[model samples]
Target: MNDFLELVKSRQSDRTYDTTRAVEPEKLERILEAARLAPSACNAQPWKFVVVTDKELSNKVGKATSGLGMNKFAKDAPVHILVVEESANITSLLGGKVKNKHFPLIDLGIAAAHITLAAESEGLGSCILGWFDEKEIKSLTGIPASKRLVLVITIGYSAKAKRQKMRKEKAKVISYNKY
Candidate 1:
């Protein structure tokens, strides 16, 4: 398999992480660099990443997560990544007429894909979390009204590297020529 392909296959969602095993600065930098390179609409690139490394802050934010599993699972990871996208930044590029749905969230999703793959390549583990209240998250992060939080991610080295996640046989999902 190609290196990139292997990286993709190797990635898995690990709910358990080793808080004692801190991710190196260089590794984190590479992950951030990868996310920074993801493409955006008209280069609007309205996303901003706020990494919470402070344990107290991480736990505080974790508590705001609505899912019981999320609150319990969050503390084990060493860092939390807040994925935020600003509507104002997007509106500038989109111009008149704020559509029923804005595209910054989509753009943020693209960047998040980059981040997850990058973390895998760096031998780090991550869980993409999204069970938190928007208002609570905004208040916790002191984020502006224009910026909406799209997702949160807990990142660090996993307690154990579980085997690869098996997908449904590709034949079932793939279509030839047309679906």
Candidate 2:
């Protein structure tokens, strides 16, 4: 695969991580660095990533996230990057009139995408978890009241070899502009 395509192709949801394996500090820093560089609306940069690598902390986060559909595999992953979205950045950028519904979460999505792809590049694995009790997460992680929890990204090294899951063929997803 070409470099870009390889980056895209390499990414997958890895839930079963080897408890013995871990992301080196330097590689983890590089991945977060990539996330830090993601583009944002008016450069609001309203996203905060709280990484949980400590087993006790992971359990706390996992306990707080247990009900979400995405949390199944997520609990096992060694670290969970809690993504918080703040409206203040965009609001401040726009000079006070808060026009939401499009800015906060969107900026967070961009950051999460960047983080995921960066992890893949480093031979690390990640899963974007979407379900969890927001209030519990905030309390568990000590996330402030002003920021909203957007996603819980589970990150760790893959315990097994890489393989493709059965998926719909690309021909079905591509379409002409008129279609």
Report backbone clashes per prediction. Answer: 0, 0
TM-score of each: 0.86, 0.85
Q: For candidate 2, write residues 26-85 as lDDT tens digits.
A: 888998899899988777888788988888778778767776354665666778899987
lDDT of 2 at 102: 65
How well does candidate 2 match the true structure, expressed as C-alpha RMSD?
2.9
TM-score of 2: 0.85
lDDT, residue 58, model 2? 87
lDDT of 2 at 166: 71
The RMSD of every model to the true structure, in order and in angstroms, is 2.7, 2.9
- How far is 89's C-alpha from truth in model 1 (Å)? 5.8
Q: lDDT (0-100) at residue 108 of candidate 2?
A: 82
- The lDDT values for all models are 0.79, 0.80
Predicted candidate 1 versus true structure: per-residue lDDT over 90-169, tens digit per residue: 45456524555556667888898899888988888887877887787788889886777889888889888577688899
Q: Which candidate tops TM-score? A: 1
